[model samples]
Structure formats: C-alpha cells, structure tokens
Target: MITVKAPGKLYIAGEYAVVETGYPSIIVALDQFVTVEISRSKSYGSIVSKQYRDDSVLWRRQGDQMILDNRDNTFNYIISAIRLTEQYAQSLGRPMELYDLKVNSDLDSPNGKKYGLGSSAAVTVATVKALCQFYQLPLTKSQLFKLAAIAHLDVQGNGSLGDIAASVYGGWIAYRSFDRNWLIAARNQQTLTQLVNQPWPHLKITQLTPPKNLQLIIGWTGSPASTSHLVDKVAIQKSRQHQVYAQFLQDSKNCLEGLIRGFKDGSLDAIKAGIKKNREILQGLADFTHVPIETPTLKKMCDIAVEHTAAAKSSGAGGGDCGIVIIDKHTNVDSMIERWKQNGITRLSLRVHPVIDLNKE
Candidate 1:
C-alpha cells in the first residue's frame, strides 16, 4: 500500500487580485491534511471516502481511458487525478494498473463542516501524489504542483491555484498565479499529457520564511464561505468596473510586497502597515462590488485583535469563514483568545505545515 498526504492552505494576502496576471499572493500550508491511500486490487479500481460513501466510483481502464461504472461524479477531483496520471503514463509507454483507493481528510469537523482551509485543493494534491507514488513516477515538486493544478482546474475551471501550490510545496510562499489564458489555449491545442509536460514560465512560487518571533492566530466564524460564488461576483463587477479594479490591484500588490518584506525583516510596524493597507483595499473592493466580503463577525474579530495590538484580516474569499491575525511572539495569546470567545468566535489551533519529499521518506 502507498499513502500520501498534503496539507490544507490559508491565504495570508492577495485573494482577488491574484486572479489577474502578475499579481502575487502569499499562502501558508496548515498542519491539517488530506490523505489518500492506494492498495493493489484484484479486478476493478474503486474509491471509498467518508465524504463520498454514497457516490464512490468503481472504475477500470478501457483502452487508455478510465471508464467509471457508477458515474455519480461526486469525486471528480480524484477521478481527474487518476485520468491525468494514466494519460501521462501512457505517453511514456507505460499503462496504469488497477488499484483500490481510500481518501480521508482532517480538514473538516466530524459533522462535516468545512473550515475554508482549501480542503478540495489539499485532497486533489494528495490524490495526485498517491497515484504517482503507486506507479513509481519520478516527478519534481514543480511537476507535481502542475499536475495537481491541472486536475483541480478541471473541476473549479478558474482559480489562482495558490492553494494547490501551498499544499504541494508547504511552508509560507509568495506565489504568482499562472496565466489562465495561456493554460486554456494550451489545453485546447494539446492532449492532457502534452499540456502538463509543457513549460509554464508565468507561474512563480518562492518560499518565504518569517522570523521566529512572528505568530499567527486563526478564528473560525462557524460558517463556511462559497469561494466560487464570491469569485464569480467579483468577476462580474470587474467586467464593468475595470478601472476601479485596476487601481485596487496595484494597491494590493504594493501592500502584499510590504507585508512579505516586513515579515522577512522582522519589522512589526511595517508588517502592521501592510496588513492594514491590504484590509482597506479589500474593504474598498467589497463596497464597489456590493458583496459582503467582510461579515460583521469578521469585523468584530479583527476589531478585537486590533484592540490587543495585533494585525488581523479576512483570510480567504471571505463571506463567513476564517480570519487571520498576526502578532509578535510576545503578544498575550490567552487574552486574545478570551476576547474572541467573548465575541462568539471559535479559535482554531493551526500552524504552518512543513513540506516533505514523499519519495525520499
């Protein structure tokens, strides 16, 4: 049996702006993970997961194509990974073998409430890694990232892929989104294997290690946010308010750069300035688009964090999910947690997850 794990992710900055070309986002891989296990099977391949007990697929290879018997389409992420891996193997004159797979996630509550920690991206990365390991495919971290991204984009259709990059590489990273137009054009012109094998120069991921004196706290608002719906709303607004969005994008880039620079140099004041500036830009975007990207609860949480002399902002495509706070290591965390609980916010115990080379391990 082969087991693979990938960490969930949180966006520290550059949420909407990263969708456009050249804008960069900072993302961190969380300690929480999604795991995929693969074992040799006798006749057919099947998937079983706590999230998809009712919608599992019993699949088999039919002349270079994976055919599903059930066709429920619930686990498209897993299926996409399998399909892409099979095609890549075939391109190298190696056919895929059948296997039984099981997926499990620690990204959700036992009751199945998602934490907006990039669960889908994590699972997609895990599945891709599991398949490659099972087949003994030698792929570098960048190669694995691109392969997982292809499978993930097949489902969501549009995203920055920061989450997938974080899951694959781990640690804190400054990532510029890939050129979606270029990727779409390439997909139209080539097979899946050919598309992944091509060079992608636009995507840039750099590991950014913060000072040891830095600290982060995540607070869950007890509600999940639909990132796709929020992104769609912003896209519609961007179509009409192109100039306004263009200015916001520029300001966002500056703010994100300042944040990373400050963190790297251990300048608390500079980091605070960057966090506040970025929050203001997001607030402006929300007002311009008439979307409640920052909910009342998120506002309250940030307000409380500020009262404690820490910097805070909404983490992801925030309607209502998690908010992040940055502080010095000497900040009184207990006091902050008490304030959050008083305001009905749930504190989540999460930290940065380190990346491991699975093949070496």
Candidate 2:
C-alpha cells in the first residue's frame, strides 16, 4: 500500500487580495491532515472516506478514464485529482492501474463540523501525492504543487490556491499566486506533464523559519462558512467597485510583505503588528463590499485577544469559523481562553506541521 498525507492550512494574512496574480499571502500547515491509502485491486476499485462513508465511489479505468458506477458526485475534489494525475501519468507513458483508495481525515470535528482548515485542499493534495507515488513519478516539489493547484482549480474555479501550496510544501510559507488566465491558456495548448514541468508565471513559494518565541492560538466560533461562496461575493464587489478593490489588493500586498519579512528576520513583534494591520485592512474590505468578513462573533474574539496583549484576526474568508491569535510563547493564555469560553468560543490546540520531503522520507 502507498499512503500519502497532506496537512490542513490556515491563512495568517492576505485573504481576498491574494487571488490576483503575484499577490502574496502567509499560510501555515497544521498538524491535522487528510490521508489517502491506495492498494492495488484486480477486479475493480473503490474510493472510501471516513468522513463521507455514505458518499463513496466505485469505479474502473477505461483507457485512462475513471468511470464511476454512481455519479452522485460527492467526491469532486478526489475525482479531479485522480483524473488530472492520471492524465499526467499517461503523458509519461505510465499504464493505468486499478486501486482501492481509502481516505481518512482529521480536518473536521468528530461530529462532522468543519473548522475551516482547508479540508478540500488537503484531500486533493493527498490524493495527488498518493497517485504520484503509486505510479512512481519523480516530480519535484514545485511540479507537485502545480499539479495539485491545477486539479484544485478545476473544481474551485477561483480564489488563490495558497492552501494547496501549504499542503504541498507544509510548514509556514510566503506564497505568490500564479496567473490563472495564463494557466488556462497553457492548459489547452500543452500536455498535462508539460504543463506542470514548466515555470508557472508569478507563482512563488518560500518556506520560512519560525520565530523562536512565537505562539499561535486558534479559536472556533462554531459557525462554519463557505470559503468559495465568500470569495465569489468579494469578486462581485470587485467588479462594481474597481478603485476600492484595487486599493485593497495593494494594501494587502504591503501588509503581507511585512509579515514575510518578520519571518525572515525572526521578529515576533513585527509579525503581530502585521496581523493587526491585516485585520484592519480586511475590515475595510468588508465595509466596501458590505459583506460580513468579520462577523459579530469574530469581533468579540479579536477584541478579547487584544485585551490579552496578543494580535488577533479572522482566519480565511471568516464569515464565522476560526480566529487566529499571535503572541509570545511565554504570554499567559489561560485567562484569554477562559474569556473565550464565556462567549461560547472554544480554543483549539493546533501546532504547525513541519515540511517533510516525501521522496527523502
């Protein structure tokens, strides 16, 4: 059996603005992961997941195509990964193989509640990694990220694929998204393997060293939000309010640049200040778009963190999912978490997952 794992991610800074080409964002991979285990099957193949036991796929390969027995489509992300990865494999003259793919995830609560930790991105990356290992393809880290980004974009259709990069690269990273228009044009003109092997214009990923005294705290608001839906709402506002949207992009880029610098220089204060600045910028965006980027609950969460001398902000699209708190490792957080409990906020114990080279490991 060939097994692969992809860690979930949370955006530290630069949310909506990172969708534009060359815009930067800071994201960290968490310890939670989606794991895929692929085993050979002679007769037929099935795709099963613990999260969606009732929603699975039974399929067979027909000339490099995966034909599902039931087309309910509960596994669009996984199916996209399979099709795209197999297409790349075929480009390398690799024969198709039938395998039973089993997936397990800890990206959600036991009750099946989402924590907004990029579950889809994790699953997609894990699926792609598993297939690459199964087919024994020697792909570089950038190539792996590009292939996963392409598959993820096939389903998501929009937004920066920073989460996919976090999953592929792991640890903390400063990410600049590639131009989607260029990728779309190239996809039609080049083979799958050729598309991944080329330099992705404006796409950049730099892994950073974490500050020695830095500490991150996550708070769950118990209300899950749709990232793609929120992204789409912002896209609508972008069309109607061109000047405001453009300003937002520039402000976000400036804020994330400082955040990235903090990592390079090992400055915790700079990082915290950058988080606060990013929070203020996101509020401006919410005001301009009239979208609830920071909901009432998120406001309370951030306010409480400020009281504790820590910088806080809503993570990701943040209608209501999780809020991130950045502080020194020696800072007292018990009182803050107690305050959070008073407001029905739950503190999550999550740590950054380190980057490991799959080939080396």
Candidate 3:
C-alpha cells in the first residue's frame, strides 16, 4: 500500500483577479490535509471516502466523460486525477493496474461542515502524487503540478488553480496563474507527455519565507460556499462592467506585488497594509458585480480583526466559508476570537504545512 497526503490551501491575498493569466496571488498551505491510500486490487478498482456516507463508487470512462457507477456524485476531482494521471503514466509506457483508492480527510469539521480549505484540490494532488509514486515516475514538482492542474481544470473548468500550486509546493507561495487558453489549445494539439514537458506561459510558482512575527489566523463562518458559482457570476457581469473588472485586476496585481515584497523583507506592516487594500479591492468588485463576495458576517469578522490591530479579509469566494486574519506575533487575538465567537465565527487552528521535497513524496 502507498499513502500520500496533500495539504489544503487558503488564499492570503488576491481572489477573483488571480484567475486571469499572469496575475499573482499569495497562498499558504494549511496543515489540514486530504490523504489517499492505494493498494493493488485483483478484481475491480474502487474509490471510497470516509468524508461521506455514500457507498464505495466504481467509475468508468465513456469517452471523455467519467460515468459514476453509483448514485452519489462525489469524487469529481479524484476521478479526474486518476484518469489524467493514468494517461500521463501510459504516455510513459507504464502499465495501468486496478487499485483500491481510499480517501481520508481533515479538511472539514467533525459534523461534516467544509471549511473551504480547498479539499478538491488537495485530493486531486494527493491522488496524483500517490499514482506517480506507485508508477515510480521520476517527475519534477512542476510536472506534478501540471498533471494535477490539468486534472483539476478538466473537472472544474474554471479558477486559477493556485490551490494546486500550494498543495504541491507546500508552505508559503507566490503563484502566477498560467494562460488557460494557451494550455487548452496546447493540450488539444500535443500528447500528454509533450504537454507536460512544455513551458506554460505566465505560469510561475515561488516559495516564500514569511517573517517570524507574521501570524495568520483563520475564522470559519460555519456556512459553506460554492466558489464556481461565485466565479461564474463574476464572469457573467464582467462583460457588462469591463473597465471596472480590468481596474480590479490591475489593483489586485499591484496589491499582491507589494505583499510579496513584504514577505521578502519580513515587513509585517507592509503585508498588513497590502491585505487591507486587497480587501477593499474585493469589496469594490462585490459592489459592481453584486455577487456578495463578502457577506455581512465576513465583514464583521474583518472589522473585529481590524479593531484588534490586524488586517483581515474574506479568504476565497467568501459568500461564507472562512476569513483570514494577519497580525504580528505580539498581538493578542483572544479578544478578537471572543468577538468573533459572539458573532458566530469559529476560529480554525490550522498552521502552515512545512515545505518538503516533492519528488520524494
């Protein structure tokens, strides 16, 4: 049996704008993870998840579509990971084998409430990592990220895939999204192996070293959100509000670049200021698009953090889910937590997962 774990990610800065190619975002890998365990099976391959109550699902591919053999529609990203990873493995002349893939997760609360910790991305990365190890494929981190991103895009069909970078790289990262149009065009014309080896335009992933005093805190609103729905709504409105959307992209890029500088210089103040500006930029987006990027509860969470001498904002698509707080290590967050508790926010205890050698996984 081979087991691999991929850490979940939280977007520190830059949200909607990061979807554009070459836009930058700062993301951190949370200690929470989705673990995949695989073992050879003689009969038929099966996929099971302890996160859901549904029975083990058997999957089959009818042309490009993955047909689930069971009623539950879960395993969307996992199935994609398996299919794409296997395609890459076969491109290398590796034999495919049936294996029972089991998934265990710490991305949700005990009552099964998701925390918006990028569980789908984590599971996809974990599955890909496991299969690569199984096949003994000597792939670089970039190659692994490419395979996982391709798999995620095949299923999601949207988003920046920054979470996949965080999962593959771990720790703090500055990620520039690749040109999806270019990737899609290349995928159609080139073999999987050829595509994997090609340089993805505007794609860059760099590990960051945060200052010692920089502290990150997470607060869950106890309400889950659909990132795709939010992103879809924003995309629909962008055509009508092209200039505003374009300005947002520019502002977000500038803000994230400043934040990256802070990470490099170990300046907590610069980081905090950049985070505050990014929050306002997202609010502007919400106002124009009317997509409710930051809910009333999330605003309250951020307000409380600001009152406590910290910078805060909604983490992801942020209709609900979690919001992140940035504060110095010397600051006391107990009062902020108390205020959050009074306002129905639950603090998460996740920390950054340390970076490791990806090939060894």
Candidate 4:
C-alpha cells in the first residue's frame, strides 16, 4: 500500500484578481493535511473515508472506464482523481490497475465544519500522488500539480488553483493563475488528453520564504465562505464595471509586488502598508460588486490585529473564513489570542508546511 498526505493551503495574498490569467497570487501550505491510501484490489475498487462517515463506495474498472456505485458522494474528489488519472494513463498508452482507497483530512472540526483551509485541493493532490506512486509514474511536482488541478477543476468550475500549487510545492509561494478558459476549451475539445500532454499552462510558482523575524498568525472567523458563489458574483460585476475592476486589479498587483519586496528586504513596515492597501482594494471591490467580500467580523478581526501593530487581512475569498496577521516575534501571543477570543474569533494553530517528496508515498 502507498500512502500520501498533502497539506492544506492558506492564501497570503491574491484572491479574486488571480482568477484572470497573468495575475500572480501568493499562498502558503498549512500544516494540516489530507491523507490518502491506495493499494491493489483483487475484485473491485472501494473508498472508505474516516473524515466523513462510516459508509464506503465500491467500484469496478472496465477497460479504462470507472464504474462507481454512486451511492456515496462524500469523496468525489478522490473518485474524480482516479478517473482522470486513468484517462491520462491511457492517453499515454500506460494503463493502471484498480486500487482500494482510504481518505481523511485534518482540515475539519469534529462536527464536520470545514476550516476553509483548502481541504479539497489537499485531498486532490494527495489522491493524485498516491495513485502516481502506486503506478510508478515518474511524474515531477509540476506534472502532479497539473493532474490534480484537472481533477479539482472538474469538480468545481471556479477557483485559481493556488491552493493546489501550495499543496504540491509547500512553503511560501508566488503563483500565477493558469488560463482556466483555455483549459475548459481544451477539455471540451480533447477531454483529458490535451491536459495530460500540455501539463504546463504558463502558470508560475516560485518559493519565497519569509524572514525569520516575521510571524504569521491565522484566526478562523467560524463562518465558512462560499468561494464559488463569491467568484461568480465578482465575475458578473467585473463584466459590467470593466474600468473599475481593471483599476482594482492594477492596484492589487502593485500592492502584492510591494509585499514581495518587503518580505525580501525584511521591511515589516512596507509589508504592513501593502496588506492595508490590499484590504482596502478588496473592500472597494466588495462595494462595487455588491458582495460582502469582507464580513463585519473579518473586518473587526483585522482592526484588532492592526491595533496590536500587526498587518492584517482576510485570506482566500474573504466573505467569512480565516484572517491572516503578520507580526514581529516579540509580539505578545497571549494578549492577541485573548483579544481575538473576546471578539468571537477562534485563533487557529497553523504554520507554513514544509515541502516533502510526494514520491516517498
């Protein structure tokens, strides 16, 4: 049996703007992970997930076709990963055998409330890695990211896939979004074959480690945001208000660039300024789009963080999820935690996940 664990991701910078091609976003892999186990099956393929329930889904393969029971839809990403990988292998004249899979994750509460930590992308990356290891496919990180991304996009037509890139590369990364329109069009024309061959989609992912003096703190707002819904709303508004949206994107780009430079130079003040500017731009977008991208609770969390001399902003789609705060090492952790608690924000324990070799699985 081959087991693979992939870490979840937290968006450090870049959100809605990353949806467009050529725009860069920053994300860091979280310590929380989704694990997948794969082993050869004698009769039929099956999936048992400990994170969701006690039920299992059984399936069988028939000449490149995967037939699932479809009774349990809890692990659709895993199922999709297997199916997409199978098609990819066939396109390359390399077929793989069926396997029994088990999946679980740490990105959820005991009662099943998601932490908005990119659990779906983590599972997709783990699934692809496990299957690739089991089949002895000599695929690099870039190749694995592509396959995992295809499966993720197959499930949800939205998202920048920055989360997936973080899971694969780990650490701090500056990622440019791939051309989703091109991938969709290719999928429509040649299905998975086109994606399998053209693994690189002009997407850039570069690792960037923050200075030792800076620290990252994550606080969960207890309210899950629907990224898909927000993305759709933003798309519609952008289409209607082209000039405003374009200006927002330009300002966001400059803000992120300043952030990158600040981190490289260990300039905490510049980083703080960048974070504040980015948050304002997002608020402007929220106003123009008529969407609550920044919830009152999230805004309050940022305000509190900034009061403590930290740079604060909402991560990911920003309706109501985790917010990020960057402060110096000398900052009082206890006081900040207490302050967040008093305001109904739950401080989550998270750090940048270290890079690992997926092939070891």
Candidate 5:
C-alpha cells in the first residue's frame, strides 16, 4: 500500500491576472488536506471514494467506466485524474495494470468544492503521486505537473494550470506560458541543459504561523461559481491596452514581492499591508473577474469585519466562494465569529503550513 497527503492551496496574490499573462502568484499550502491510499488489488480493478459526509461510497471501474450513485459530482475530479494518468502511462509504453484505489478528504471548508482552496488540485497531486508509486516511475516535479495539467484539462476543458503547478512545486513560483516548440528546443539544447543540471544553494523554508492573537476568518457565499466560466469571461475582455487589468496585475506582482520579503523578515505588519494591497487590486478587477465582490450574507459579514479588522476580500474564483479577512491582533475573534454565525455566514479558521517541509516527514 502507498499513501500520500497533499495540501490544499490558497492564492494570496495574483489570482485572475495569472490566468492570461502568466505572472508570478503566491500560494500558501494549507494545513487542511486530502489523503489518498492505493493498494494493489487482484480481485477488483476499481476506484472508491469516501467523502467528508455520508456513508455511501462512490465506486468506478477501470477503462473509462463510472458508477456514480450520488448526485454530487465531486468524484468526477478524481476519476478524471485517474484516467489521465492511465493515458500517460500508455503513451510511455508502460501501461499500468488494474488496481484498487481509495481516496478520503478531511476538508472542513463549507460546500466541499468552493473557496479556491485547491480541493481538485490536491486530488490531482495525490493521484499522480500514487500512480508514480504504483508504476515504479521516476517522475520529477515538472513531469508530474504536465500530467496533472492534462488531468485538469480533461475535467475543465480549459484551466489555468496554476493550481497543479503550485501543488507539485509547493512554493512560490513564477510561471510564464511558452510555446510547445520553444519548450522542446529549450529542453534539448545543451546550454539550457547545463543550466538546468547545475546545482543551486539550498534556501530554508520558515514555518510562519499566524499570530496567536490575530484572526484570519473565511466566510462562505452560498452561490457556486465555475472557475472555467469566469476564466472564459475574462478571456473575452482581454485587450493589450486594458489599463485597469494591466495595473491590477502589476499591483499584484508588487504585493507578492512585498509578501515574500515580509515572510522572510518575519514582519507581521508588512505581511498585513501586502495582504491589504493585494485585496485592493483584486477589488479593482471585480468587473473583469465577476461582480458584487461578496454575496449579500458575505457582505454583511464583511461590514462587521471592516468595523474591527484590517482587510477582507474574496479568496477564490469570485462570483461566490469564500471571503478572507485579516483582523487586528487585539480584536475579539470569537465575538466576530459569533456575529458571522448570526448572519448565516460560515466561518473557516485556517493556519499556514510550511511549503517546503510538506513531503519531508
């Protein structure tokens, strides 16, 4: 049996802008995660998933067959990941045999699939890890990323590929889209090969915990939005001279750079400032990303947060998911949460996990 735990991610800066021009985005791997276990099974070549709620099990067989007994389509992501892996294995002339895989998630966030917390990306990462183990395939992070991208495309048809990249690399990454032919030449050229093969100095990853007295609150908006839909909408409005969008991207980039510096120096004030600036940039692009910023319930919660907090902004694909608020260290977090409860907004309390040390132990 082989088991791997993949952490969910939150994009702190550069969410919508990253989709088009491939700017640098900062994402933190959260403590909340999904655990996948795969065992060699000679009896049945099937996949089974036990979600966060209910006793009913979702099962599917190998070779493009599905057995969905429930109404929820949450299991589709996992199935897509599995099928994509199988296709890649075949293309490599090392087709995998039938095996039974079981997946379980411990995600406590509302609506299981919202919040841009990387629930799908986590499953893709974990599935790829398990397949690599099962096939005895020695795959690098880049290879895993490519395979996961294929899986994401299978599910969504069009995707940003940022989530999978973050999940595979697990740290701050600057990604730019390159032509397929250009990538091929770069991979094969001797100069690029030498540069890639060179060893680099190791940088330590600090596990920075949120301040004990400070409060980070995430409130859910009832509406469910499709990320692909939002991406398509933004693509239609893409013009080179879109100054607002361009300025938003630049601001996000600056904010991300500030965040990196703040994180390194352990400056909480700088971090808070960066978060606030990033949220402002996101708010500026609301029309391009979606409208209304936060839901009605979420707006009320945000009003209460603004009265006593530092900043608040929608965390994910917008339209409707969850909003994150950074509060002052001296603020009453419990009372704020209680107020959110009274207003029908679900509050999710989360902490940051070290990006580099995730796979160490």
Candidate 6:
C-alpha cells in the first residue's frame, strides 16, 4: 500500500490579486490533512473508495466518468483529481492500474466545509502523491505542482493554486504565478529551498506551533463564494483600471510587507497592524472582489470582527468563507468566540506551524 498525507493551507495575504498580475502570497501548511492509502486490487476493472460517505466503491471503466458517492457533493473534487492523474499517466504511455483507494481525512474544520481551509486542494495533493508513488514515478515538486494545479482548476474551475504549492513544498512559502503560465514563480524558489535545506540551531519543529496566547480566531460568514466567479470579476475590474482596485492592490502589497517583517521579527503588534490594514484593503475592493453572495455576509463579519479585535479580514478566495481576527494576547478569546456563536458564526482555533520536509522522514 502507498499512503500519502498532504497538509491543508491558509492564505495569509494576496487573495484575488494573485490570479492576474502575479503577486506574492504567503501560505502555511496546516497540521490538518487528508490521507490516501492505495493498494492493488485482485479485481481487474474497479476502483473502490472505501472511505466515501455513501457510495463506497466505483466501477472503473476505460472511458466512463468517475463517480462519487458522498451526498455533500465535495467528493467530486477527489474523483476529478484521480481521473486527471490517470489521464496524465496515459499520455506519457505509463498508464497505472486501477485500484481500491481508501481515502480518509482529519482536516475537516469542526464547523464543516464553510471554514475554507483548502480541503479540496488537500485532497488533490494527497491523491496525486499517492498515484505517483504507486506508479514509482520520479516527479519533482514543480511537476507535482503542475499536475495538482490542473486537477484543482478542473475541479474548482478557478483557484489560486497557492494552497497546492504549499502542500507540495510543505512550509511557509512565498508563491506567485510566473510568466510561463505556471502556477508558481521560480524567483522565491531559492528562499524556500534554503529554509528547508538548512537546520536552525535552536528551532525544533516538533516543539513549535503558533504561540498559545496569541489571539487568532476564524469565524465563518455562512456563505460559500465561488472562487472562479470572484476571480473573473476582479480580472474585469483590473482591465478597466479602476482606482479603488489599484488602491486595493497597493494596500495589499504594503500590508504583505509589514506582515513579512512581523514574521521575521516575531512582532505580534506589527502582525496585528498588518492584518487590520489588509482587511481595510479587502473591504475597499468589495464591489469588484466579491459576487452578490459574498458582499453581505463578509461585511457583517468584518464589522463584527473590527468591533472586537485589532484586525480582521477574509481569508482565501474571500466573498464568504472565513474571516481571521488578530487580537492581543490578553484578549478573552472564549468570550469573543461565544459572542460569534450567538450571532450564528462558527469559530475555528488554529495553530500555525512552520513547514517541514516530508522527504526527511
């Protein structure tokens, strides 16, 4: 059996802007993950996914579309990734055998699918890795990234690809779309390589996690925004050279700089300030950044978060997924969570960890 575990990701900055003129985005791989275990089956013509919620096994066919049995409709993304990988293998004259693939995940947010923690991307990465391993394919990280991006775009239609990049590379990564139409830029490649290749004298990764007392809360806005729709809208707005859009980009850039500095220096105050400024910038681009489904709920969450914390902004493709709030270490997180609960918002507590090399273990 070949087992692969892939990390979920959270975008700290540069959401919509990353789609067009590539901007730097910082994403961290979370401990939560999707695990895929693949083993050969005695049967010649079937693909069985035992961990599926409803339809546990699918009959494989040469030209048939993949089937997913999950009632939640999220399982389709997994099926799409598998089909794409299989197709890619065939194109290279290295077709893989159909197998009984049992997929399971511990990455679902307690609040469910609305938390926007890159569940789809995690599944894609995990499945891709497992398939490659099963085939004994020697693929570079960049190659894996390209395959994952194709799977994601096929499933989600429009995605930033940053989440998959972080999952494959496994660390805090500064990623951008490059001129080659590839999802990741090569400029920041060396920085990521250096961090992974060298060991810090005092940093023990197993002992490290996001600080316990730091106030970071993720609140759901009760709406799921279509990433593709929002990206298309933003693209149109940028083409017109809207002033608000320009300011939004500039603000995001400035905010990213501040956050990078905060990350380097371990300054909580600076991080808080950067998040606050970044939220404002996102709010300014609301008209173009979000479709109708995103505006109302996102605004309400932003308003509520601003009232209680130092900074709050929508994470991921925005519109309405989750909003992250930065508060002082001493803030009453429990009380704040209760308040959000009363307002029908679910709260997710996350511990951010530095990326590690999966190949090392």
Please list the C-alpha lDDT of all candidates, in the order they appear: 0.86, 0.92, 0.91, 0.85, 0.63, 0.64
Model 6 worst lDDT window (10 residues): 200-209
Candidate 2: Cα lDDT at 296: 91
- Candidate 1 residue 251 C-alpha distance from true site, Å: 0.6
**Where does model 6 exceed 4 Å of error?**
45-52, 56-76, 83-95, 107-113, 180-215, 241-244, 288-309
Most accurate candidate by lDDT: 2
Give the TM-score comparing model 3 with the true structure, all chains together: 0.96
Tens digit of per-residue lDDT, candidate 5, span 1-361: 8887777766655577666444555555666777788887653555666763343344544453434445565566777777666655655566556577778775534445555677788888889878877777656665666666656656776655666665666644434332333333543563422322332122112233444444566676555666777767766655634776677778877777676676567566776787777767776777555654456665676677776655666665666767777766676677777887887777766665455433351
Q: List the residue pairs that clash in candidate 5.
A: none
Residue-pair clash count for candidate 5: 0
Cα lDDT tens digits, model 6, 1-361, are 8888887777766677655445656677767777888887644433344344555645444443444333444456667778766766665567556577777766664444545677778888888888877777666666667677667776665656788887777756666653333323332453323322333222111111233445566677666666677777777777786776777777777777667777666677777777777766665676554444335566666677677765776777787777777777787667666767777777765655456455641
Model 4 RMSD in Å is 1.8
Clash count for candidate 1 is 0
What CA RMSD would candidate 6 show?
Answer: 6.9
Instruction: Return the clash pairs for model 2, or none.
Output: none
In candidate 3, the residue pairs with backbone N, CA or C atoms under 3 Å apart (3 or more residues apart, or in different chains) clash, namely: none
Best by TM-score: 2
Query: What lDDT does model 5 reach?
Result: 0.63
Please write out the lDDT profile of model 3 over residues 153-203, one tens digit for every residue: 999999999999999999999999999999988988999999888789999
In terms of lDDT, the poorest run of 10 residues in model 2 is 352-361
